[model samples]
Target chain A: MTRALLIGNSHVGPYLNALKHAEGEVALDLDCIAAFGDGLERYTIEDGVFCGNILDPKVTGRKGKGPFPGSEVRAVLKDYDVVLLTGLRFSIFQVIRVFRDLGLVTMDSSRDYATAAENGVTLVSEALLHRLIAERLSGSLMMQIARDIRAATDAPILVLAQPRPTRQVLVEGTRFETFCNAEERGEGDFVSKTYERLAQELCAGIAAHYVPQPPGTIDGGMFTDTSYMMGTLRPPFWKKNGRPVDFRHGNARYGARMLKHVARELETL
Target chain B: MKNPYSDLPPKAFWKTGVVQTDKVHWPELFVPKFTISANSAVATAGSCFAQRIRQALADEEMPILDVEPAPAAVEGDLAREFGYGLHSARYGNIYTPRQLLELLQDMQKDAVHKALIWERDGRYVDMLRPNVEPDGCASVKEVLELRKQHLARLRELFETVDVFVFTLGLTEAWIHAPTGRCLPVAPGVIAGEYDPKLYRFHNFTHSELLKDLKAIRVLLRDIRKGVKIILTTSPVPITATASGDHALNASTYTKSTLRSVAGEMAMKFKDVDYFPGYEIVTTWARENPAYEANQRSIRPEVVAHVMAVFLDAYGLRKTGAADQAEPAKIHDDAEYLEGHDDDLVCEEILIEALQK
Candidate 1:
């Protein structure tokens, strides 16, 4: 059995929740520790052990009943064979904002994109766009955590992207209008693939592997399917009823699907 | 009889003015015909030296009108690499007066030079400013589309600029044989095949330079009445000349002709003035020359001194550096000149490589 430890922000909920009910001789045994917002920023790793707020009950909102509950025991890096770090702040929505801000158009020949110049936009070269994306990812929290983990242990580290926003993001009145427009123009796949490549390259800078979201779980070109977005796992102490639609997180099914993909990727590695 | 020479100031004689004077403190090198205050809506274009001028003015908190600006997201060297923040508009290094004249004319017209698009390895480049898009456009259609937008912005730039600074760069240029339109660089150097039958080299004569400058002035006034013009000859010499003359002789001829024409224009027009940038780098600094070891790129300190004199003469020098917007950190000369990342982005420099 492969011992995997996942540590990150609130995005860790689904993955840890899926691991709770996981049964019948699974090849992967998973453990998780999570903190929301800047809660993780307070923690530091030293001598192969994470220090500060190992499991702050007040900060994580887990109280005690969640799969990964509050504990005074600090997590050690060398305890696991493989380490997974999610919530490194990779978001396709933010990538879309960059494209819109720069008025950048890709030269993906397979899809017929409208000439950017007609709309007073500039067509950036692929090499240049790659540099811009890499620059954007360089200072990400994921990169820093990966470096920290690499310094502490020789264990293989995998950086998982935050689940892509739901396909419903393309609907009218949403803030992702430019993203929706790009989809209408058939540029979605190219942008997503380009982001994936740059994100992977970012991981490689620290000798870590970037595990992308499972292709099966994604709908449209760069968004998680609605089926996976609903019924998302949240902290147990959270509001029991009438929470707004969670468009950015995935349900336990997605976590199970993604977990399987991660296992398969690890076997090859 | 007391001759004109006897009564003249120390600057009139070379011995007192140049050889004996300290290089750091040359007296009254440039007396502006008109003052350019910090509020002046300045626009800059021309050769590589003009970029230095743009940077200096931007540093002093001058209102440099940039119509086609790099979006805030694109910062520093990358912004400049894509031809932003290099000039008032993205027309990179207008090496010849004819090219500048043609660009101004194009700004007024609602047209695209479709024939100017050249293809290499399935990618297209706008031959006019080939280096602006380092990777060529995806198609011939994309090139034309971009050029159309660029020209529109140029029109806006011309209409709004209060002061326009142009630096004369070169006398030699390649022209389309049929249309007589000048290209910024040789065809094959950046992109496209060099068809001798289609393009030919032409060196602008003294008379031709004067004529082109005349037409440019007329057009500027026609576009925006009473707009002031500042003309300076680039101190940096041509990297290579297509004329059969030796490189040194060719460079001298190019600089001299441009200097003469600029002087003539300033003499004729009250609104036009000549800044002795060429003289500052070449003549005054006889012992400690302004040029780097390459003899092409000017030293950063020299550039700063030139701008100091310019801004000081016009009473436009900023009083306090504290209030100024954090200017883009200017790179030193060595890195800018040594690598392919020429901050000046001189297309003419590419010619030296082709000569080998």
Candidate 2:
């Protein structure tokens, strides 16, 4: 039986489910190793088996830890043929700081400016924090884990690039008022520019295959898409002028599309 | 009043003049001629009601242009604080046709202008003085000179726009002090400080709305003379108004006036159509009598139904097929999950924190 191991951020969960459904429909005998959690932790693989925590206790702590432990990751990877990675959350604060320092973002809101010290710290830390983590826990760390697992059984390592879902374009005439309101509040410039930059960066990274998932798509199941769903899940308890107004995120339709894309990728793997 | 359904024949039995049968055949209230199919490049912009239009069209599988620069921040507060997508106030109103035209004008005049200003920093940054891109017209005169050129492009876009839908959001707006520019909301609402002397509320008279419609039509005709325009009045009420009128009364007056304007325009123009999006949503589809939440937005399901009717009438194709199959099972997953699940808690905290 061909075994596949999937790991990454929240995006991996939906993709794994999609792959499973597709395999069932196609009648393929494929055992899959699916591990999805925060990317800040280390996953371990041992003696032809995937085991160990998918998240490091030191990094995430118990409250923020993954559903499983590091031993499970090691055991799962040992028996899996491939590992896939994707993230739903992006550190937009960091991207905004980059642009702000570069003079791309000009306007600062009272709140943004008031918290500038705190935000600055977050921005600085995020920029520097990921690289060190990558050195100790990612890149070579994953490679090392794979090598160790391979010592017991030889399996090809296929790291698929994350899929970048299509961005939500503001419908003309509708979003302008809200956008302008944000601007007046002082945080407008920083918030708008930073978020946009973050999307572009995410899309660019996914397009470039710098992040892992599948070619030609970004993970839409991430926190970004789900947040929309949460916001609009229920219509606002009150409305004005008889028109129902609510913000939206990823509906089931978008989720389905992302799932199908993952299913197609699973076929290739 | 002549029956609007006069053109529609009964689906079941045809009667000569007035034959009656037990089988009642009500003509489909709306029949969509097309669906938003996959691979279509769709763009939506207009007024606040346009948001509903976009959502509905998106649900039907139509591709909406992601004008929001950043659409991938996992944290709600960060997304809001950063200004990703259409939800930010910095983009400053997506509903105004004039503003949309102005933005396009800027982009056309300067090739890099939009990318530099709107698409940079992952969001649209507020520009007190918008700079023209190098490839665009150098002066305001040059920009005006290219009005015809821009109009042509807009017309072309309209022709290919399988569904050219818009919502007449308001009959009231604030005009800029110095430039005499019309803004959808008051300066203090979005950007610029509120200076009573600089901003004055102007409730558009029938004549002004008619004039604007004519101008818009003329501009559109320059692009695609045969393009169809679908207009609707926003049913969402006003939260607060500087007009001295009570909020409820103001909302009613604005919506009624806009609805009448849309109806008149539809009658005057053959290619123009008016959809009872307001009536269908507020009355026919409303499950709640109040019609809004405390914040004054419409219910999601009501909006969904309004859009479904729109698609039914327009016959537009849907864009994303892989996305829509099995709505039931998907909704089931959400139902099965507890209210305060991990995802929910995180999102709730994020959105609440960000609002601050």
Judging by lDDT against the true structure, name the best candidate: 1
lDDT of 2 by residue, B26-94 (tens): 125444333444555555555656655665666666565443333222234334233223321123234
Q: For candidate 2, what is the total of clashing residue pairs?
A: 122
Tens digit per residue, CA lDDT, model 2, A91-120: 232233233321111334212222333333
The top-ranked prediction according to TM-score is 1
lDDT of 2 at A14: 42
Chain A only: TM-score per candidate:
0.82, 0.41
TM-score values for chain B across all models: 0.92, 0.61
In model 1, which regions exceed 4 Å deviation?
A5-7, A24-26, A31-85, A104-130, A143-159, A167-211, A219-222, A233-242, A267-269, B5-7, B19-25, B193-195, B284-287, B319-343, B352-355
Report the lDDT tens digits of candidate 1 across residue range B292-342: 656777766667777777787788777433223242335566554554433
Q: Which 10 successive residues of model 2 chain A have the least lDDT summed?
A: A121-130
Give the poorly placed runs of model 2, Cα more than 4 Å off.
Answer: A1-269, B1-27, B31-42, B65-92, B95-162, B284-290, B293-295, B315-356
lDDT of 1 at A233: 39
Pairs that collide, model 1: none
* DockQ result, candidate 1: 0.25
